[model samples]
Target: MAAKRLREAEESGEPGRRAGGGLLPFGLVDVDGPSMVPTLYHGDRVVVRYGARVRPGAVLLVRHPMRQDLLVVKRATELRSKGWWLLSDNQFLGNDSRDFGPVPPELVLGRVLARVRPSVSWLAPAGRLERLLCGWPLGRVPGLAARFGLSRRLSPLR
Candidate 1:
């Protein structure tokens, strides 16, 4: 039924629905490497908006500066005269503008809108780990707490 609905939606040139999730504008882009770690895991899925203004501090997907067809996800650092400066959130694990310099503003594909983490059982013995995992600054506290039977705790950083 869900697939049928998706097909119908596709045929009609409208958003598709499947398994309670609607079609995405920018679609799913798998996060790889530790540059976005402690926030977006390696296998995490991100929803993006293509061709949007690359705002500073926003995560973005862009064509790798050296390799045009290769896409990379990084934080927008600065908008330079040549293009946009891209940097990674994780200083130790990222190889971004610091290495290849500014990326062509046109190569940028999209800005990340949101991400849904994989579900973890708080009732299990690894509840502490679960808290640490979902405690990133992306605003998943309520959902994480509700899923794990944990009370709202103070901000992880503060």
Candidate 2:
């Protein structure tokens, strides 16, 4: 049924679905870019709890500060006076707090609860281990430095 709903939403050309006018508290959004690669890929479907409690390390669906029409998925890396200091799992890619500065609280739409498309992954607030995994070269062809004989975590600073 959710798949059907997504398909209908796609046909209608909407970015995602906001559950029936307060009838439901969740919404569906598609992961649209490489900013969150490895952890989330393009076309991945996610379930977000609208107005859910926000926490550092939680993944959230946020409205772009400068471009309101764009919705972005990012990790709430820090809480500043303005709002969340968001960052991408793939630091090498995507626009994040480094680009737009802290996002206002109201622009945060929800916390991502799980991924439902392509696969099912409960998106609990990530911790150091999870963040470590995001930078680790695992289960990926490009991640393997087997040829070079010295594969290291993608990020040396971490």
Candidate 3:
């Protein structure tokens, strides 16, 4: 079967990634805002691990208390008295902990390990790429959610 071959390739440690395999030994997350800007983007893919240590500059995905279903990614700024005070890399962006207040460490799902950007070796110039590198907003999560649809929609049938 196709899956059998993919599993074999993974076991072989081939440079060619197998289907459903990741570049790192962690879950891959899609960046959703300009919070991490040049370091991360709206569409860039990032790897994260559940037990990764939290650091000042590390970007993280955390659950919103009021809306537990909604997950937001932001830079870990300071460990404030209340909780972790997260901030967006783009100072102009206002939809972060600075607006919502400190977030509990329990809310954090994982820490970003690395980022992967879209390759454009054979394509034309992209202004978005420039903005991404300049610490400005360039990617979003809505498009990713729409492209993949809700988790419920993607669930396999019995």
Best by TM-score: 2
Q: Please give the distance, in angstroms, between residue 1's alpha carbon in candidate 3 and its true position after superposition.
A: 38
The C-alpha stretches of model 1 lying farther than 4 A from their native spots are: 1-24, 119-158
Give each model a TM-score.
Answer: 0.59, 0.67, 0.56
Per-residue lDDT tens digits of candidate 2, residues 43-130? 8888878788886667787778998756788878768788888877776865888888889999887788788889887775345444
Which number leads on lDDT? 2
**Candidate 3 C-alpha lDDT tens digits along 116-146:** 4552111111334423433423234333322
Native-referenced Cα lDDT, model 2: 0.66
Per-residue lDDT of model 1, residues 1-158, tens digit only = 00122223334544454211344444555566677654466766665566666555556777787876456777776688888887665667546887887788877767765664453322221434544745775236456533432223211110
C-alpha lDDT (0 to 100) for residue 119 of candidate 1:
36
Taking all chains together, the TM-score of candidate 3 against the true structure is 0.56
lDDT of 1 at 96: 80
RMSD of each: 11.5, 8.4, 14.2
- Candidate 1's C-alpha lDDT? 0.56
